[model samples]
Target: MFKNLKNDLPASIVVFFVALPLCLGISVASGAEPITGLIAGIVGGIIVGAASGSKIGVSGPAAGLAVIVATAIGNLGYENFLVAVVLAGVFQIILGVFKAGIIGYYFPSSVIKGMLTGIGIVIILKEIPYFFGIDKNPEGDFAFLQVDGENTLTELLKVINALISGNFDYGATIIAVIAMAILLLWGNVLSKKGKFFQLVQGPLVAVVIGIVYYFLTKDSGLELSKDHLVSVPIPDGLSGLKDLLTFPDFSALTNPKIYITAFTIGLVASLETLLCVEATDKLDPNKNVTPTNRELFAQGSGNIVSGLIGGLPVTQVIVRSSANIQSGGKSKASAVIHGFFLLISIVTIPTVLNLIPLSVLAAILFIVGYKLAKPSTFKAMYDSGWMQFVPFITTIVGIVFIDLLWGIGLGLAVGIFIVLYKSFGNSHFLHKEGENVDDGKIKMTLAEEVTFFNKASILKELDQLPENSFLELDVRKTRYLDNDIIEILEDFAFKARERNIDIKLISERGIIENPDSFIEFFKLKKPTE
Candidate 1:
């Protein structure tokens, strides 16, 4: 790890810049203290990073869980919510021990792509209000309907209305525009000029510029207020830091609601973590595969520690992980270093951090959102075919209109429906050369493996066979046949004789003459000479 410090150090700095605002934003969105988000980030970096099998994936408080955390906190109280977080961590550890990580593999590729795209759209929509200096809703809130009795579409209209009525904050708009320009220039031009520019990072520069602009315009009409900047609890000393931490109420263990909340958090956090692992692995240039079970164990440990220290639940987050990858992170050291940065910055420069404008962070998130939901992604999915395109689009629509889990469920449903449709239609092959069924020979070739899904198609084909027709039932290529199909064939043999139809049965074992039952014939295999 030390050998790769040349690359990891710079990557860690970039990831730190990207994660700082997000940690604060997600905490506010989750209805937790900003300090809680910072604590989670620190634990995720130092503890989880040390324990995780992933080389590049970063863990923290995720925006996807903001709604769940907020609702759980409201229902369970903050102390009880911490209890739930601890229990959720225990649950994740159990899942890891049971080797349940394979469940991530069952999700279709199309659905995963759809999920990434959906999240990107949500990020763009949620950040637009912040970009315009409207702070009615918390940063990182991505639900279609908001806690403030407004929806995504209405929020956009509110921004537009503010602009038309001159209710917008020019300070925020100017800072945001400047921040975006700097980020674009650094990424496209300046960063390419030298390692120093890359090490410093565009987002860090944007943040510093935002702070400078805040002080420069303090007495002007374009001054940004405290509400428009990052807010970290400034503690005076070790005693003040001690007061910032909150412990879980062990008394809540008996409450059924606590258990319910714990289950919800565990399920959602595990899913989001698994998805991030998949996405990050794809982003890794070396194509390294992270151990999913180990990741779960690491995340569970981090959440336990975080909750004990008054932090929000932690999960592997794609946003930070992607930043780490894009910034040239070579190992888990980068993640660990970023965590230390979060820790040191909050403790050492809380005053300076509080000066950075929220508009600048919004601009940074806008770039992240665009990269995730690029238009080219949609075209590529469409080019893959309707099977991929349908689920991909459905997931995006569901996420934009509904919620993340609901969107993934809808995409999975569509993917499963497509599979069933294909299975129902392509179960077998029927060939008949002549038009007259009475004279022509009918050949029914069974698929490689016939299941109950093919039962309907098989029955229909059998019923349409002409009386006195010569039918050949072929199962030479079949490896396994469902019991229902075997019964169907057995029952058909008796009925075929009644219709004066001559039927020949073919299989790898050999031909059967007037078999009484397909099951009996298969069970009575001849011994080798």
Candidate 2:
């Protein structure tokens, strides 16, 4: 654990910076106290991160949960929401017990890649507000658009209005710009040198600068600006702690809606986690495989704790987890350590956290978004194969135009369509190369069950057989043939009479089903030849 701790601590700090804004944003978007996001992050990091089997996956409250969380809070009240979270955790654990984690593995490579790139595109679109000092919600959109607006473009306009009217705070903008500058410098310049500078990460730098910026603002007696800063609730020592606790309503468990809600959240969160894990692995220079089942179990544990503590349910979120791996996280320990940092920061210095600028975090996420949906990513996908390129590109567009799940579903459906079309059209269903004559005879083998789709190739093969040559149609292995093929055979037999062609059926049992004409044309029952 110590060895693991060594590697995870640095990675954890990077993850912590990435995670902090997200925690606040998701909670605010969910209509819950921003502190709830921190609670979820703490549970996700400490319980899920520590218990998780994935070596590098970092857990936290997911933006994907914002819709459900918001809806649940509105419909069931916040206390009842806790019950759903616990129930969702239980379902996730059940999924883990049955080894349903493999479901993630079954998704096509194209679909998974598509899902990640799509999420990246959505992140980029949604974060435009924060980047420009526009504060709607950091990055939460379900069907499309935000609660206060429609589309990223509309939100940007709102931000412009906020900025021009002297409504937007300038202090955070200044700090955010500096944080971004430091972030850029850290990744591009400072990281190259194997010196004291390399030891410090950019997000950490942004965080430190944010603290100083806050101090400067506070000392100057500037007006409070939630827009310019991280706005998560910070309890004042013991009293704030008391206000945060909540008890679940057991009666809510009796609501069937709770179960449906639980399943939807559990299933979606798990899928998002798996998608992030796959994308993160690809981003890894080492190219390691993640244990998906263990990840589900870990997420389940986190959700359970999160629910108990009045936090939103958690998952292996890619935005932060990817940052961890990119920052050179050596193991899951990094993820676990980050959880501790979140807990300590909230418990000891949440007031300071509120001081950190949202713009700084936006800059960090912008970097992440760029990495995910880089122009090069599209080029690389195009180069890889159509099986990958189509779904990946479509997923990005779909996700951007719609939401996370819809985009993934659309891309996956297209991918499956391609797979099935290829499966049934030619490769496995028909034997083409074998149709050429062998010593004046052609043999065509029928699959165990021949459907109407087999008619084209079968008829084409029959037509190609030499006018005077013998053709052996084997149905011994076949159990069923569609009527379309039977009709084609019946028509061909009539043609054979004029062409002096010899057609033979080789089967242990006589033909039981065919066109009525075909049945009458071959009147001899069971000609045992």
Candidate 3:
């Protein structure tokens, strides 16, 4: 990993700028102290990044978990909630040990893509208001309906109304517009100039310019207040930083609600981490696969440490991961370095960080969001067929209209339904060679894998056979035949005898004549073997 520091160091710096604001925003949105988010970011980067098998995935406090964390904190109180988070980490470790990471494989590719796209749409929706200088909701709230009594679409409308009525903050709007322009130009042009330009990053430049703009407009009507800027808790000194950390309350372990909350956090965090691992692998230029089980273990460890030290739950977040990838991260070192940046920044220059505008960060996120949910992505998925497109579209709709988990659930349901439908129709193929039923010449070719899903179709075909029919049952191509199908064929053989039907079973082991039982005949050992 150290071999690629030339690339990794620069990528780490870019990810640091991207992660800093998000850490602060997510903490405030989660109903936790802002410092807690920074702690999670620090641990997720240094601990989880070092421990994780993934080379490119970046873990942090995710906007996806903001709702769950907020609700849990409100119910259990901060200290009690920290206990739940720690227990959740324990549960995740257990899951990793049991190899439950295999659950990640069960999700269809279409649904996964839909998830990325859905999250992109959510980010764009959530950030648009901020970009336009409308800041009613907190920065990291990414749900369809926010805790502030405004939904995604309604919030967009409110931004439009505010703009029309001239109630928006001009300082934020001007800075945000200029920052976005700088980012676009840097990405499209200046970044190509040299390694130095690439390493510096457009977002950092945008932020610096935004701060300067803020200072320049201090006494003007276009001035932005502290509320419109990044708000990391600034300590008076190194000693004051110690007061920000809050440990979990062990006494809450006896509460049943704590157990429920733990399970919820563990399940959600594991799922989010697994999905992120999959997406990150897709984004990796090297196409290296991350060990899903090991990732769970790493995240579990990070969360445990984070909780003990008063941090929100951590997961492999796609936003930060994507930023790392886009910034040319070559290894896990980039993620680890980003964490150190978070730690050092909070310890050293937090007061300076406070001067950065939220609008500048929103512009950066807008670019990230747009890239994830690009129009090209939709077109590509649509071209893949309805089998792929339906689940993909369903996931997007569900996520936009409902919540993240619900959207994924709905997409998975649709994907499963499609698989079942195809299975039912593809059980077997029937071919009739002879014209007359009296002659009774029929051939039934079984599918490569015949399952219980094909039971009804096979049974119906058997019942339709004419009396005194000659039937050929072909299983030469079959690799697996379900017990249900075997039983159906067995019962049909008995009925065939009563109808004076002659049966010949042809398989890989040659032919069976008047088999007493389909199961026994198929299971019989071959002489050559």
Candidate 4:
């Protein structure tokens, strides 16, 4: 894991810069103490990262679960919620043991692309307001509709109004612009000039500049307030940090609601983890495929540890994982190191950490967002044809307007419909136009598997047979014919007689002349092996 220390160490710094605000913001959004999110990040990074088979995928408290976490906390109390989170970990471990992680492999590649693209768009949109210091919502809340009563679109509209009225923070906007400029220069030019630039990393530089700017502008008209900065809870010492940690209530074991909440958390967290593993694999430069079951087990163990210490539920989040990959992380060591950073920084230098401006982080995320949702990616998907493009576009729209899971569900539904439509048209093949011209003969070969969905197309073909025609029905290649299709053929046999059609049934069993009933014929002839 430490083999790529040069790469992983720098990348870990970038991920730490990216993850710190997210940890605090998601915790606040989830209605938990800010320290709880940090704990989850620590566990997810150190514990899950060490156990996970994925080299680049990063796990932490997820934005997708904010609503569930908040609701659980409100309904059951924080202590009971911690109990639910612990149970949720147990459930995830059970799922991993049962090999339920394979469920992620079934998602179409187009949908996965859509997921990455959609998240990129969300990150850009959500971070825009932060860049200008219009920070009403938490940084990690990625849902379309935010907890602040405004949707993503509406929030942008608010930002525009704030800009027009000159009601925004000039200090934050100035810092964000400078940070973005530094990132662009460092990434596009400076990083290529020498190894030192790559080793330092643009994000870490931007953050340092932002902190310096914060101190320089203090008490001035352009000064940024606490709302525009990273917020980590400061503790007196090791004992004070320990006092902040809350343990799960074992007394809640008898509560049925706790189990229900646990199930929900487990199911959602596992799904998110699996999806992330798939996406992360796609993002890997080496094209490494993570063992999904191992990822689930790692996530389960992380959640268990997190909950035991009063932390939020954890999932493999795309934002952090993508950031890690974009920052050139090469192994799990990066994730583990970032966890150590979070642990050490909050303990030793939290006040200084809080001095970093949120706008600068927003600037860093803007780059991450652009990388994921590049305009070229859209054109490439469009050129891939509708079978791929439709689902891909639909998922992006669904994610932008709805939530993550709902967007995937909508895309899956569209993809399935397209598959069925294609299947309906491809049920069987007819002989060449000029073949069997004598005797008005027509040959039809059934597909490998004919289901009820193909009944209409088959029926139409049979009804179009000319009077006095010779029909050669071929099932030599068919493996399974649905009862509906068999019934259709049986009904068509009676019509064939009226049309004076001579039917020749062909199968592995034998050929028959004018077979009486398709149902009986199929029953007598077993399907080919």
lDDT to native, each model: 0.82, 0.72, 0.84, 0.85
Tens-place lDDT digits, model 3, residues 1-529: 6789988898898789888878877888788888899999999999999999999999999677888999999999999999999999999999999988867756666787899899888888888888877874567666677776778888889899999999888889999999999999999999999987887889889989999999999989889888888777777677887788999999998999999999999999999899788777767766666888999999999999999999999999988998889988999999999999998888789878889888898999888888789999999777556766899999999989888888889998997897676555563544444445556588878766665445445656787888887888877777655444565677677777888889998887899877898856754631111
Candidate 1, residues 1-529, lDDT tens digits: the string is 6578888998888788778877887887788888899899999898999899999999988677889999999988999999999999999999999988766655666777888889889889888888989863457765677766788899889899999998998999999999999999999999899988977888888888999999999889999988898888888765578688999999999999999999999989999898778767766876666888999999999989998989999999888888888878899999999999998887788898888888998898898888889999999778656766898999999989888878888998997787576445554533333445556577777766565445445766787888878877777766555444565676677677787778778888787656677767644531100
In TM-score terms, candidate 4 sits at 0.80
Query: What alpha-carbon RMSD in Å does predicted model 4 have with respect to the real structure?
Result: 14.0
How would the candidate models be sorted by lDDT, starting from the highest? 4, 3, 1, 2
Candidate 4 per-residue C-alpha lDDT over 23-84 given as tens digits, one digit per residue, 9 for 90 to 100? 98789878888899999999989999999999998899987788889899999999999999
Off by over 4 Å in 2: 136-143, 159-171, 214-226, 238-242, 425-529
Q: Against the true structure, whose lDDT is highest? A: 4
TM-scores of the candidates are 0.79, 0.76, 0.80, 0.80
Q: At residue 85, what lDDT does model 4 achieve?
A: 93
Instruction: For each candidate in turn, give its C-alpha RMSD to the true structure in angstroms.
Output: 14.5, 15.2, 13.8, 14.0
Better of 1 and 3 by lDDT: 3
Could you tell me which residue pairs clash in candidate 3?
Answer: 440-470
Model 3 TM-score (2 dp): 0.80
Instruction: For model 1, give the 10-residue run with minimal summed lDDT.
Output: 520-529
lDDT of 2 by residue, 221-307 (tens): 443266677765566786678587776787887788888888888888888887777667656655455777777888888888888
